[model samples]
Target: MRILIHDYPGYAFPVELARALAHRGHVVCHVHFSATIGPKGTLARMPDDPETLEFLAIGISGTYRKYSLLHRFLQERAYARRLEQAVRAFSPEVVISNAQPDIQARLLATCQDMGIPLVHWLQDLYSTAIGNILKRKCWLLGALAGAWYRHVEKRLISGCAQVVCISDAFASEMKDWGIPDSHVVRIDNWAPLADIPVMDQDNPWSGQYGLAGVDVVLYAGTLGWKHNPALLENLALALKERPKTRLVVASEGLGASWLAERKVEQGLDNLVLLPYQPEESFAAMLASAKVLLAILEPDASAYSAPSKILSYLCAGRPVVVSFPPENHSAQLLSGARAGIVCSSGDDAGFIAAVKDLLDKPENAADLAINGRMYAERHFRIDEIVCAFERVLNHA
Candidate 1:
């Protein structure tokens, strides 16, 4: 089968899936938006990559204006046109669309016109997330935009040949949206386990970043509107007394910028802010951490499941996640005994969890072991690829 996997964010595991499918004798063309601002995967083709696997980075003229609503909308439309051209050029038998509802909706129309089966690789509920964020920022405009987005998203979901949901929570949402259970398939998100191996704390990447002798609580992903950056600020303030302990955040975007300003204003020398590290340094960066942190606002908990937590687990590090209890991430951490799971608003509990991990090395080690073990057991690429194959072939 010739498959075109369009993952807008270029996440690690999706690239891994492309490789796996290619290895299984399918010709795969994996595409991502190059101008997106976030931690990306191994977007370039490696020497060991299969001959049938091709990676393409489709990009716009300038940086993606994520916060500028009008500019961002124009950019998204431009990106969709470029994406459509790429799709027409490849003309694969099956298309798996991930992230970016607006872009995916455009692609859906193209696929229908071309008589190609397009699978919706549902990662996040963009409409709900946008609604929550916008409503908080501006009520009337937010409601109007939110409703428009919701309508578009519902059409996209229903129009797709298949929907691959990342969590069971999403399946419930699908049901509420009047999507048939037969149209939805639950395939949990995962990390590239092989790519993110467990590395030593004193590795070259850590040394280069001056993380050699520090007790680091790190958050290394997109800190966007769906997240509460204040939690990170509070965590940094809480760790002020411990000179050796550092709050390292490796990210870019509005939330990161806010944190940067807060770091300076509060004189938080203990807060170390860095842009997203290169793909090669990712594992080592995670290794340098005593505890990994992830956050999701209560509003986002229903729709967005942070894939960073999976990478944190793959790095063999204890994780401290702040999200709602019912979130798949929280449930996964709780069930796997990976680390501590605190509610989004529980700043004190989150602080205590991080401190506990830092203070009790033995307990942290145990949690790290459990997390890695769970990843090893469940994140088998062959199994995941087979599951994807079933859906793609059927579609």
Candidate 2:
């Protein structure tokens, strides 16, 4: 099957999927948005396939950095024309669209015109995400935009040959939107595990980062409007007495800024804020953490899953998550008995959980092993890629 995979902000799972598909002898053509933001610079990149033409980067700016909604709307529409032409030229049998909220209708229409089966890969409920991001200022505007987005989302899902949702909550939401269960496949997102092998605590990267002999509770990822950084503040306060335990934040953006400020103002000696590591250092950085951290605003969990959780598991570190129990992240941790899950904002509970692991290194190691095995069983890259292959072929 000639499969076309589209993921804007071209990184992570989709790229891995494309390469894996090509390796498996599928004629995979990946179309990605070309924009580099955040530290992991290759947000857009072509898979290394010299023998076969397999990857194409569609030049488009997907990030809305303090831009007016009108400009963002115009730019994406312009980009859609180029993307549409590219898809027409490729003439793929199936198109799997991942987290593509921009110019969605146009993409769907283009595929429909060519009689190509379209698979809507639902990563987040963009309608809800936009509304949540907007409700900070005006409720009425948020609601109106949400209603419009929901309508479009419903149409796209209904028009698709199949919908692949990354979470049960998202699948359930699509079911509410009248998409039949049979048409929706529940395939969870996975970390790029093959590249992230478990390293020793005293690995060179850990020593280089000065995390050699300390208890590092690490939070690494993009923490946007959906996450609450105040919890990190609370955590620092809770762990103030434990001089050996440090909260290492390897991230950028407002959340990282807030944590840095807290370290200065509150004199959180245990809090260390750093920028996102180079890709070469990423796996070892993750391995350096004694306890990896993941958080989601309880409500945001319905629409967003922190793509970093599975990565943390593959690093063989016990995770400490602050998410609603109902969220899949918490369920995964609990099911594997791999980490501690406290309700978001429960600083005392989170502290206790972290402290429990800190005090008993053996227990933490056991939890870490469980997490590693859980990821090995459920989040293998080959298994996930195969699942997607079956869906794309069948669709």
The lDDT of each candidate is: 0.91, 0.80
TM-score of 1: 0.98
List model 1 lDDT by residue over 101-169, tens digit each. Answer: 779889999999999999999898888877778888798877888788889999999999999998988
> Roughly what TM-score does model 2 have, to 2 decimal places?
0.91
Return the clash pairs for model 1, or none: none
Model 2 per-residue lDDT tens digits across residues 360-392:
999999999998998888867778888988898
**lDDT at 36 for candidate 2?**
31
Q: Which regions in candidate 1 have their CA more than 4 angstroms from the true location?
A: none
Q: Ten-residue segment with the worst summed lDDT in candidate 1?
A: 36-45
User: How does each model score on TM-score?
Assistant: 0.98, 0.91
Q: Which residue segments of model 2 deviate by more than 4 Å?
A: 36-50, 60-75
- Give the Å error, residue 85, model 2: 3.5
